[model samples]
Target chain A: MFNDFINQFWPSTVDGLAFGSIYALIALGYTMVYGVLRLINFAHSEVFMIGTFGAMFVPFVLGINSALTGLALVGVIVLMILAGMLASAGTAVALERIAYRPLRRRGASRLAALISAIGASIFLQELFALIVIPNVFDRPQQGRIQMALPQIMERTDLFSIAGHPVKLHQVVVVVAAVGMMIVLDRLVNGTKIGRGIRATAQNPEAAVLMGVNIDSVVRMTFLIGGGMAGVAGALYLIAYENTNYYIGFLFGIKAFTAAVLGGIGNLRGALVGGVTLGLVENYGAIFFGSDWKHVISFTILVLVLMFRPTGILGESLQQARA
Target chain B: MALALGLAACGNGGSETTPADGGSNAAAPGTVKIGFMGDLTGANAGIVIPPRNGAKLAIDQYNKTNPAVKIELVEYDSQADPSKAVALAQQAIKTDKIVGLVGPAFSGESAQVGPVLEEAKLPSISASATNVKLAENGWKYWHRVLPNDGVQGPGIADFIAGGAAAKNVFVIDDKSEYGKPLADAVRAQLATKGVKVTNDSLDPAESDFSSVANKVAAAKPDAIFFGGYYAAGGNLLKQLRDKNVDAKFLSGDGSLDKGLIEGAGADNAEGALIGCPCYIATPDVTDAKVKGFADAYKAAYNADPAIYASEGFDAATVFIEAVKAGKTTPEDINQFISTVDIAGVSKQVKFAPNGEVEAKDIYIYQVKGGAITLLGKAAEAKLG
Candidate 1:
């Protein structure tokens, strides 16, 4: 058993970290929205989904088929990421304006807003499934089959760690996700708008009294969070090489769990939670078979909440610095 | 005694009233309604949609030839869900009042819908549902054009052990109702032949199979048999090849699809063997009927028939022949279908007492140059 554990450790860790990076990027969206509005933006996952479709559609419209290579591949990747971010940010702002903004103007209860968020999530998913994707994108079978993305880069081994060959795509995913997170972290900590967001999250009424435009700050938080999720979506296509309408549901739930596990309103906590969840799930699969991987991940969440409810970082929005 | 007689009279009156209403109904005397059910809008759409098209083509051909007796095909999409299949079966029997049915294309859906249609006395000939247990249910109304997995699995095992001369084999399944039982049957057959066999299962939703691929490479098997659909099978094959596991890959009919080559890439999919009961109308096939059917299919759908399209055409042909032979009532159709023997495009269609195809055979297909090439019939391909 010990030998088995030792042998599977490095490779599982590599797989876990690569997957975890994606989770972290998605979790940042949940964490930031919770920080400002004290509302769980359930539709954020759909925002990520729209980002992936945007990434695929932009290249397709530009006539970038499988033949792209070298510098052209790099240019396409950057363009895809930018397109994904723009689409996701646009969706997030629209959702805020349409769904959450009405509830806010009406001074509705938080529960009503949360339910509205859920409605938005389902509406977006079905819209893509039934109407928008099939008509606008001309993918009549979009919802039914897993659409294979154009393989932009050849899957070549970058290097081996402990006899395990790490592919170049995996490296790309991890680097891009981590780099985006670092940039987000700095922006949140070092900017004037960042201070406004921090103040609003700490005490919304107080921030309003202090002449901070609370609505703009909230919208900005959603835009930034949705942008991170969009980058994650682009990276996910490069990593998994497939996408469908329902892809967001599973990834969304997992990212939400990561947000909760990392201390819901804490930025750094979300990252730690994601990486930990991924590592735990991978190692658990090794010990208890791959079939029980999901069970183990969710069980870990229950165990964590049972012990330390605030999660690993154990700090809420008002308590933690940016 | 008076109450029982009164109840019987009411029941008799009710039975007489329905047929009287149905006789004068929108369906004229020469019109025969047949219901076709399958997953037209779900994960299995790629497999089921072709068959639906084939059924349509067969109906068109029948209508063109026989102008007097018109066959109207009432179609239902089950979405591959069991509850939905049951609802659709109920609708076909009660609402549509169909005398014959074409499919519940997947095994799981067929299993749920079979007994319901059987109780209604509606004869259904499935194009692709090949679970062996479906035939064993003793449901007299159910029939299949394709041979069950029981025959196909052993045929695959024999091809691997004898024709391919593989010493050791790894059997993997997706833990689905269709995949798991088929893998078990293959493993049992392989073990009976004194060949070494290893077993594993995978989640179909998972895209990454690197760990599983590495484990397979370490095992050093001579061949690998995956009993699953194309999506996971293609990913697994690609990962296995990437890990330098140069084992021969064999799979059941579920993986015999153009999507397999598309997913795994033509380079990775080359030389993989697929065992299927349905015949592939390769370009070189000289059977005039099959060649005609293939040409007509290409002209109609603008592509060659996928795995089960010909089987679907054959199934519909069987029902159309029965209708032409003066089998109108559900019971009459069921009785006629039970003993059907016709030379279909895919096979000589004949059902045994167990509702299985009497002509038990499997075709061995090899992926060459991104296309499925028929090697030979499995029994003939086998070596001593």
Candidate 2:
């Protein structure tokens, strides 16, 4: 088993990173929301689900049944990503304005907010599962069928490690993820809006006293975070080539685990935790069999919590200024 | 003596009028109740609803024509839960007093409800539950319309070993109650044939299967057999194909839907082999009765019948035959169903001593031209 793990290390790492990148992207939403609102956005996973539908609708509506190449491919992929971002960001804002805002105005407890978040999550999942699939999409007969996305990019062998070739899509997913992370990192650290977000995370009351609009800051946080999850959704479609209503269920749990593991409010920590979780699951599956994959992920989460409650990178989003 | 006789008569009248007053109003004179129970609104509802519709269709047709001994079809939704199934089974036997039962749809539920129905001596014929251990329970009242998973696992495995002649096979399951046992049966059969079989499993709830897909690629097996339903099976197939694994892909009846094609994308799913014990009535079947049933089902449901629809119809037909033979009580129905021998829409309906169907044929299906097409029985299909 050890020798087999050694032989398949490179391919597993590549696979792990691609998935880890997605987890990291999603973790951003959870960490960002928790940082600002002090409420875990359990419904953020559904936001990703909505983005996947948005990305899928691009090819379906465009009548692009066949694969595109060259500049056209890049243009369409950009459009798809933009659609995803718009949909997710819009959803996050609406969820705040419609669901969370009312409760916050009524001075509801955090437990109430958590329940509302979970309720919203189920409502969205079922809305897609029952109403959306049979009523709007193709194949009305199979209500729970996973809708296949049209091939956006032609996956060709880019390179091989240890005689196992890597597909172009795998490389694209990792590159796109890193690029998004860099863009997010630069935006949060280099801009005035970034400072405003960091200031709020440090102390919402103090930032308000310093004349920062806490409401706008929270909205912006959700927007930026939801947008990241949206791109992850698009990349997930490219990687998996399938979409369903409940696709977000397990993914939501994993991303939340990633966020907590990386230090709940830290941007860089989410990335590290996601990639680490992904790599550990792959390696653990290889060494101990795939059944232990979940056990391994949760074990890492528990160990991190027990030993270092503040997480691997040690600080929340406040550390950006520190 | 006259007062005692009056009291006994009043007691009998009081017992009969309660059920007469409260529902079961249809139980007038010569009518009796039959049951159809399964998951009508849960995850396996997709699997159960087809059979439920088929059984309903059969009884509707029977009631319309026969008119002598009227049969009212009662439905109880178990949602594929075993505890619920046991409870529903009790209600069907004691409250509704149904003479025969069509299903508890899934294997786990069937196992739970089997003894309940047996204890009541209510004749039952499951339309879809294909667990082989179900037949080993020694329940005289419990029977199934189709072949067991034991027949299905070895039927495709036999083809894989002889027809495909694959030396190395990779067996995978979603670790579901349905998939795991079917996969085990396939692996066991392949082992007996001296085939090198690699085994693995995937979490059914998670769509991502890249890690497992990579393992399949590295193993470099001659073919890959996955024992799971279509949704997860399709994603795995899509992933394996994306990596250009190129090995032959085969799955059991659980993956025999066109949803498999939609999930894997038609291009990736092409040449995939699927097996099912249920038979569909194609356009070429010359049997007027088969075509009539198909036409009737389509007209009634306004959709093409899916897997196990015919078997459900067959199970209902068995009970209808007993009712037509003037068997009204559960004991009489049980005795009548034991000798049941007729041509069903799915296949020949004949029961062995152990309550499994005698005519058990596993049909081979292939994905060709972006559609699932029947390639005849698995024993004969040279998919290699």
Candidate 3:
């Protein structure tokens, strides 16, 4: 009986870890932006959605008509990945400038940021829905853009331990996320700009007195956070290979949950919280049956919040300011 | 919030003139409205929109030649939420001037909306809702264009276990009334066939399913059958691959949406099967006019026209046939519809005494190369 239960536990743990990687990547954006601005960027999910749209649009832009030689196809796909990332990064910058920057400038409360995010989310979703795509085929096109590429976007053999198949997308999500986190860690902890960000996050009035360009730090934070979310979005579409107007809402909430679970303002907490939440939720489904999985994830989040109101790693707003 | 309510209230006020389902004056009312109720914004939009488009194309073409009776379509987005469907049905009956109703798209909505139409004595037909409990509820007004899941569940069981020789099957449901009951029906049928079934139920609201996949994959069942709509099912299929599970997947018509394959990622979902209630087998639908309808539908809608659209067209066609047969009063139309049998898209459309499709194909399709290729097309169970 115990052996059966143990067998179930291990597989669920692996499932959780794979999903956690994606959650962690997206959660980083939420945590970092919150850390700097003390405001939750609600349109972050729509940014993710736009990133997905970017990935879907990229392959079509490459003009790879059919299965080219494997090497050539790889080159095109690589170009697509770079183009998609750039597009997502560009979108993030625009969102920061257009939607968030003005609010920060006006010294709007966090509620204003929340409302702007909601408005931005609706705008992006409707934009995609109503946007007319130029048809190469004479047929009337659906709102979605289907790229002519290999249907299977992820390779399944890399992390296969013994005989188990490791999803190529999972590996990409984890590696890219870790690499981005490390770069972010360096930017925040080791650079002059990092000091400006910390100074702004610590005390806006004092930071201004200290001659810190708070605006640049805020813009830079959004740029970095948006870039990470863009990568996450591109990775999701590449892995899932479908784009829709509202798909981001589901993953967005999960990522937010991960952000809160980890101690919202802490970068490392976002990573730890994301991966931990993913594994816990996935394992919860496994042990209690699939139906109760979500109940379990939320229950754990509630429990964690009850015990440590600041989250497992998140500092309270006061502590962060201090 | 009040503005939103006011907007809805304004929309409701306009639909107040919607015709009662059964009124005394059925004599040559120059135009007939087919009321539509289904999700426009939420999850069921994928299923509802395509069929609505298909029905519109059929109505437009039909109206061009047959000037005596023109079909006007009135729509309400139920968001695949049942309570919303009831409110929409009430509006359709009271304000939209509809002679017959075309849809509520989903079974749960149909179940709730069905009784209201019965109370009104309105002859309404479901375009896609396939739950058996719907027809068995003793509602005189409710009818379905497609056969029920009671027939579909066993047919799927026969195909997967008996024909495909799948030894072990894992079944999961979204825990909604439609999803759970259908999953239960399939499990019972599989048990009858002496097949081993492992079953689980999950909340439909939860999008992630890595844990479920992990637990199910450990058993290594030959196929996974999810009796739920596309939203949760699509995520499940994706997460299963993410968790490295390679088992074949089979699901009911609830999962039969273009989004399912797109959302799940086409390559990973290869060899995944869907059990659909109605499909137009080209050879069987030999009429050039019907073929023309299919072409017109595919041209107007980017995706292939679903069987539900054909069924919606059939339901509309049934009303047309009934109108042509009699004095065009409610009693005459009702009697005419009960007796007539007409060959339309999907099958020869005939209703039982309880208002269900008498003969039809409930097919199993495999998603090979991102297209739904039909496997075994079985006739609807002739209930004893």
lDDT of 1 by residue, B7-121 (tens): 2222222222123222122676688787678877665577887787788789888887866788877667676888887877786687667899899888999999988988888
Question: Residue B175 of model 2: what lDDT?
Answer: 84
**Which candidate do you rate higher for TM-score, 1 or 2?**
1
TM-score of each: 0.91, 0.90, 0.84
Q: What TM-score, to 2 decimals, does candidate 3 have?
A: 0.84
Leading candidate by lDDT: 2
DockQ of 1: 0.26
Clashes of each: 0, 0, 10
Expressed as tens digits, the lDDT of each residue in A45-151 for candidate 1 is 89888888878777678865474667888888898899889988899999999999989989999999989989999999888877777776776754656666656
- Candidate 1: which stretches are off by over 4 Å? A1-4, A135-137, A141-143, B1-25, B242-246, B382-384
lDDT of 1 at B176: 82
lDDT of 2 by residue, A1-322 (tens): 8777877688889889999999999999999888878899999999999888878878877888777899998888888888888988998998888779889879899999999999999998888776776676664533455688867777789998878888888888899989999999998899988889999988988999999998899889989998998999988987787888878888899999998888889999999989998898898888766767899999999999999998888688876663
Runs in model 2 deviating more than 4 A are A138-143, B1-35, B39-49, B69-99, B112-122, B138-140, B287-292, B295-305, B328-331
Per-residue lDDT of model 2, residues B1-384, tens digit only: 322322222222222211222223236667788778776655446567778778878888887795788887777767577887787777667666778899978888999999988888888999988888998989999999999899999998998897778899999988877889999999999999999999888897887787788788779998999998887888889888988899989999878777678778888899998888988765456789888888888888787777788889999999988888888888998888889899999998999989999997999888998877778898887754
- Candidate by candidate, in order, the iRMS in Å equals 5.9, 5.7, 5.5
lDDT of 3 at A276: 89
Judged by DockQ relative to the true structure, which candidate is superior, 1 or 2? 2
